[model samples]
Target: MPPSTISRVINATNGRDGELVTSQQCIDHIRTQRVNNIGHECISIIRHFQSMTANDKFGLPFAPFTGVNHHRQSTLLGCALLADEQEDTFVWLFKEWLKCMHGIEPDAIITDQDRAMCNAIHSVFPTTRHRYCYWHMQKHIIDHLPTLVSRYGEQFQRYWGLWCNSSSIEQCEGYWVEMKEKFDINEEGDGWLQTVYKCREHWVPCYLKDSFFAGMRSSQRSESINAFFDGYVNSQTQLHEFVTQYKKVVTHRRLSEAHEDFKSLNTKSVMLLGHPIEIQAGEMYTRNMFDVFHTEFKGFGTEFCEELRKDIVEYKVCKFTDRGKWEVVTYE
Candidate 1:
C-alpha cells in the first residue's frame, strides 16, 4: 500500500496511541511530530533575512489567499487550522502577517464584492486601493438582472461595452446616464445598479484608470492558483498528504514556468501584421503578448477619421465583420 493509504489507516485507527483521533489532535501531531523543525527553520530564515544589510530597504512581501473551501470533517481542512472567511479573522490575519514584514503594504488588491473582506482590507491596509473582480461583477449583474439581458440584449451589450471601455470619468458618466435613460433603470428602481454605483470607485475602470494596479482588474489569478491546487489535492486529503502534494504541485508549476521562460528567451514569434511595430513587439514581448498586440495593430488600420474639430476628433472604428458597420466616437 501507498504511504498515504497507510497514514490514513493509522490516523483512522488513532495511530495505535489512541490520542490522534480528533481534528485538533491530528493537527497537533503533524505540527509537533512532523513539521516542528520546518517551522523553526522558517523563523530562522526570516531572522537571517532581517539581519542582512541588503534587505534593510526591502521587506518580506506576501499575497493574501482567502475563501479556501475544503471538507469540514477533514483534519487539514478544518476551521481551527485554516483561517475562516470572517472580517475580524481576516483583519487579525493581515495584522499578524504584516508584523513579520516590517509594515510594508501592497499597493492594490483585487477581490470579490464581499462586504466583510472589503471592510477587513480597508481596516488593515487603509492606503491600499481595493478593486472588485471584473468577472465577479459582470456575473452578479447578469445573475441579478437576467431579464435585462434576455429582453434588451443589444442595449445591454452596448451598455456593457461602454462601461468597460470608457477611457475617462466624463465619458463613463455620460455613457452611464444614456444607459440608465435608455433602459429606464432609474425609473424601474433597479437596486443592483444603485448599489453598484455607490461603490463605483471599487469597480469602475474610469475611477481606477490612473491607479497602479499592475494591470489587474480581477482576482482571476488568485482563482487560477486555487484551481492549480485543486489538481493536486481534494477536500479529503489529510494534513501530511496535503503537505506532500503541495510540494509536488509547486515543483511542477516551477518547472512549467521555467520551461516557458526558456522558450520565451530562445524562440522568436512569427509576425502577424508584417508591420515594423509588430516586428518590434515580437522582439520585445512574449509569444502570447505579441499575439494581443498584433490583433490591436490590425484594428488600427480599420479605423478612419470621420470629422476633425479644433478640440475634438471624431473617428469611426470598424468592428470585425464583412459588413462595414462602424463605431463613431469623439476624442478630445
Candidate 2:
C-alpha cells in the first residue's frame, strides 16, 4: 500500500513492462494482477459484506424490497432488505443492486409511487420503463381524501380506471377534470394528482396500445409474499431469522411459480394468462374503490341486449363509504 507503488499499480498500462522488484508494487500488482480494479472492489463489496438495515419503523413495517413478476398472474419475483418509507434507503438499495447486477437487462418494473423509488429508478434503470400501480394511487387518494365518500360517492373509483386504463390522454384528462370538480379535491389532492400524473406517458399510452403491464403494476402481489412469513415478521422476529425465513419464502415462491408453469404447459391458457390469477373475494378486491359498468340501459328498458349484441354501455365505476367497516381495512 505504498503511495508510489499504489499509483503504479493503479496506473499500469498494457504496454508497460512486467515484473517489479518493489514489495509494495508487488503487493498492489498481485492484488489486481488478473482483475479490473473497480470490478474487483465491486465484487468484494457484494460477496464478503452485509447491507446495513435500520430499525426505524417501530410498528408494523413493510419488508425492505418486494416485487411481483410482470405476468398478469401473480408471481413473486424477488425480495430484498428494504427501509421503511425512507426514499434514501430505497435509492441506496437500488443503486447497490445495480452495481451487483452489473449488466443484466430488465424488461419492466412496477412499484408504488414512492418518490425515492422513482428517483432511484431514474438513476439506475434509466432505460427500463417504470410504472406506478393504479391500485396504489387509488389507495393513497382514498386514504388522504376523507371527504371523497360524501362528495363524489362512487365516482372516485372511476378515476383510477380512467387514469390507468384510458386509451388516450384526452380520456384520462377528461376523467381527471371531472373527478377534480366532483370531489372538490383540495390542495393536498392537487399535489397527489400531480405525482400520480407523472406516469401518464407510460401506463396511459400503454393502455391505449392494449398493453397491460404484468405484475409490476400492483404491490398486492408483493404483500402476498410478505404474508408468507407473517408470523415471524409480526412478532418482532430477529433480523437473522427474518432474513433466513425470507430466503425460504423466496425458495417456496420460486417453486410455486415453477409448479404453476408445469401446470400451464398442458394448455395454452397459461400462456394467454401469463400468471396464475388469485381467486380472492371479488367484491373485496374489485368493488367499491372503482369499477366498470354499463349505464346505456338507464332508460332503454334494460332490453338493450336484444337490440345490441353485448351492446352494453361502458362507464367507470366507483364507490366511497364512511361506514364503520373502515376499521377493518387489511392494510392502511
Model 1 misplaced regions, further than 4 Å: 1-81, 96-102, 146-167, 174-191, 212-216, 272-276, 301-332
Candidate 2 per-residue lDDT over residues 295-323, each given as its tens digit: 22122221212122234643332222346
Candidate 1 similarity to native, TM-score: 0.58
Q: State the local distance difference test value for candidate 1.
A: 0.67
How much does each candidate deviate from the true structure in C-alpha RMSD? 14.5, 20.0
lDDT of each: 0.67, 0.54
lDDT of 1 by residue, 194-221 (tens): 7887798898888997687644667776
Reference-based lDDT, residue 115, model 2: 74
TM-scores of all predicted structures: 0.58, 0.47
